[model samples]
Target: MAANMFVVRQTKGTVLCCKCGILMAPNPANMCVTCLRSEVDITEGLRKHATIMHCPECDSYLQPPRTWLKAQLESKELLTYCVKRLETDLIKVRLVNAEFIWTEPHSKRIKVKLKVQKEVLNGAILEQSYVVEYVLQDHMCESCTRFQANPDQWVASVQLRQRVSHRRTFFYLEQLILKHDAAVHAIKIKQMDQGIDFFFANKSHASKFVEFLDKVAPTKRRESKQLVSHDPKNNSYNYKYTFSVEISPICREDLIVCLLELLLVWGISDRL
Candidate 1:
């Protein structure tokens, strides 16, 4: 019988913490023990230092330095361009943050998680939030074929909490869904029930509208479709296709829009 073994030796050298200016003994990755412990801080320093700014209108701290924010905005612009370049039935594109939290001392360095939503449809959840890094959430609308003219329109209402950031994101995503030719026709929005009611001209329109809604819906682990009824006075059959989504709260708009688009497209295809 034979035994195989190896001897380990410690190499001595001075490693300095990028921050705090502390000298430490040699270790793995050329980082000092203390620096290694505070890896996130060290990485942040390596990147740009974010500044915290206050908004007089809202009295809230804005994370990420102005420069960093500008860069991020520019990146988003680039993404929009790229999405536009893709030749598909997809009419809209959006980037959403799921969970955004401001740590101590308002620096532009925000803890942000991101997601992407595409087309959507009925009985689907469009937006979702989770405490994780970047995740992808996408949807596609079913192809629209038959369209009716001059149908009666009705409004759907829901309540939403008032918050500038979330509100802005939601509106932005809605506009994106509107970009679709089929989803755009005969659609209107009104504020009611603490949220907003999205109106459509007919059952088909409402079905298409729900598709767009799904795109912006949140992500959910277990989602099931439910059928909701409209008033009997309209002289037409009315129903709503509903579903649940799970995702990070910050990126809800994106998920909702994506789900809506998928559902709308699916409905159209089903009719065909």
Candidate 2:
């Protein structure tokens, strides 16, 4: 009984490798781990060629096809972007090291050497290095496309009109907006009679601007919307919003004058 059990164990435990013709323990691939790895490539899904979205006008790469809030002009970011685009569906790929092989800005061809790692069996990782060639294709982003088509197009407008016509007040407001980056979404700024107009492609941006103004200056605001266009098939409504913001004319310097004038003329001032 013991001799028969030993034979059964040997038959089940070992396999003849088809490539090397070596007798070894059977693994998931019906061959030894070493032979299986050698015969089959671990980087089968990894790509050798890639195409990156490049906008010549903006000199920016299209990442995820949206407005990138953060700056991605660094070499590491650009390299990673190309690698991700090439190996779209590859899983468990860790970048060990990356080196630029050749970069031709004129031809728009960038070759990079990427040393990547992947897990195989029993948590054992395999590292392989490959030279990936990236071809930068001219693809216009949404913002650039819109600007190229028309420069003066906007979706919403912030009509800030104060009671007094003072350019100093508008200058102060511009400084605040620039310091806090409150108008990051504003595509264009147009100087109006008493105040500056902030134009945005999104209504939420106009709403954010209004919120920022409320914190800085106590203002009375009235909003109105006009139907620009509507798509019945897509069930989408496109409307242009106008935010008329009127800040209090009584500033700190004019506070006493306003109160005294109001009390003298209109019986009594509520603030006083």
Candidate 3:
């Protein structure tokens, strides 16, 4: 019996790039690694035609919310949001800059300049420029719609009152509310001779307002609820809540000292 065998050889090979005649190894086509990666248009996945949700009456744009409360986003923030929506998983994105171009007057369409740096294969950064178009579509938010249709469609209200009419205290309270972003929850704020009234679309917000006031100043509070609507089929009932808060009168300069002798006479001392 006889057997035959042959030697097999392996060799390293290099290919020229299809576009640019550069040497690259392990390339599927005759293209260099750099040129091959650059050929993949990341902008293809980018959304060219986009619609920005905007309210013409309020002049506010729909923004991604950080909280549960309804809020409007600024122009720059909205632009960032649009970019995120346009980006795809093909490349890693780092937004360089964005600008809105005023092409013409009375035009509903807006031209936006987006400069982004994308990281492709081998950690190579590719800079991409795109002029994205966004059509300003008129869309009304829930809060704005409620404001327009029924101005007084609030479910709860807080009546803040002080025995002495002091604008300074009320002014301080207003400043605090504005700082805490609590005022955004209120549908309306009404001024009265005794104090101010804050109307809220939800009872939770009204209760939050009362808690905020209590933390700042010691107050006596009274609550009342009235049945507003009933759904018989669903077995649900809706009630309007009213909270009356009476803040204790106190000034920065005022102080009171209690004597030990008085406590002894009243038998309120711990030793007694």
Candidate 4:
């Protein structure tokens, strides 16, 4: 026979509520859940409504002090975005749970379900559920403002011409441009009789675009530059270039490549 031993269990002592006189665990208030909820509210002073800056052109929201971020609906990114906006409002309380509440279709409004916990009555913690609403206000983003503010800021251009008298081939070019997103760097795009014109603020971008067209279709390229300004003191010359691209039915290396370039002045410097 083997020797056997018995052990005693240690448990925390329980107490009774002062108001309702019911058995409960120890707490700062020594009260029940129902009584504490009825007495104090942790959702006090929480904002019920707020306005958010939204850019309709870009589908992005402003995060104050000149920061723009993208957040899709019903996502954690949006939840964090909402919480960040409420940092000042939540100074007194702490967030326990935050989530997006579905809004009416096509309303462009957002509602967030919130749960906050706060310590009160000297160490007693209380959690409460509430909701906050966000009203979207239309605000144009900086990039959109730049294009709208200065339509004539393009510095270089590529004029694409294809000598086709009949059926649409430039239409095919449009599809190709859309597929490759090659026009993202262009400041402006205009449709012409022979073909299309792509405008850019940077001459290098024009060269890149001409390269793209050459790769996608049988084409020849030419480059030309005209003197714009001469700084005699600095011994520098500024020249504007124009690029003319001819789209051919067949590749011919003998055809001369043409380029046209123009210059426009702007305040911001292009880091690229």
- Highest TM-score: give the candidate number: 4
- Candidate 4 local lDDT, 161-230, one digit each (tens): 8876743557777788877867766766888887788887789989888888888887877788888789
lDDT of 1 by residue, 23-94 (tens): 865444445445444442211112112223333221232222321111122245323432332223122323
User: What is the C-alpha local distance difference test score of each model?
Assistant: 0.39, 0.74, 0.71, 0.79
Question: Residue 266: error of model 2 in Å?
Answer: 18
Candidate 4 Cα deviation (angstroms), residue 136: 0.6
Query: In candidate 3, what are the lDDT values of residues 152-202, reduced to their tens digit?
Result: 688999999987745666777778876786667777788888898988888
For lDDT, candidate 2 versus 4, the one ahead is 4
Q: Candidate 3: TM-score?
A: 0.55
Native RMSD of candidate 1 (Å): 22.3
lDDT of 3 at 39: 78
Tell me how far the alpha carbon of residue 138 in candidate 2 is from the true structure, in angstroms, after superposition: 12
lDDT of 3 at 93: 62
TM-score of 4: 0.57
What candidate 4 gets wrong by more than 4 Å, as runs, is 1-3, 9-13, 149-272
Highest lDDT: give the candidate number.
Answer: 4
- Candidate 4's displacement at residue 65, Å, is 2.8
Report clashes for each candidate as comma-separated counts. Answer: 81, 0, 0, 13
**Candidate 3 regions with alpha-carbon error over 4 angstroms:** 1-50, 55-82, 88-93, 96-114, 119-124, 128-138, 163-166, 229-237, 249-272
Candidate 2 at 112: error in angstroms? 22
| Candidate 1 wrongly placed segments (more than 4 Å) | 1-165, 216-248, 252-272
lDDT value for candidate 3? 0.71
The regions of model 2 sitting more than 4 angstroms off are 1-141, 151-153, 256-272
- lDDT measured at residue 175 in model 4 versus the true structure, 0 to 100: 88
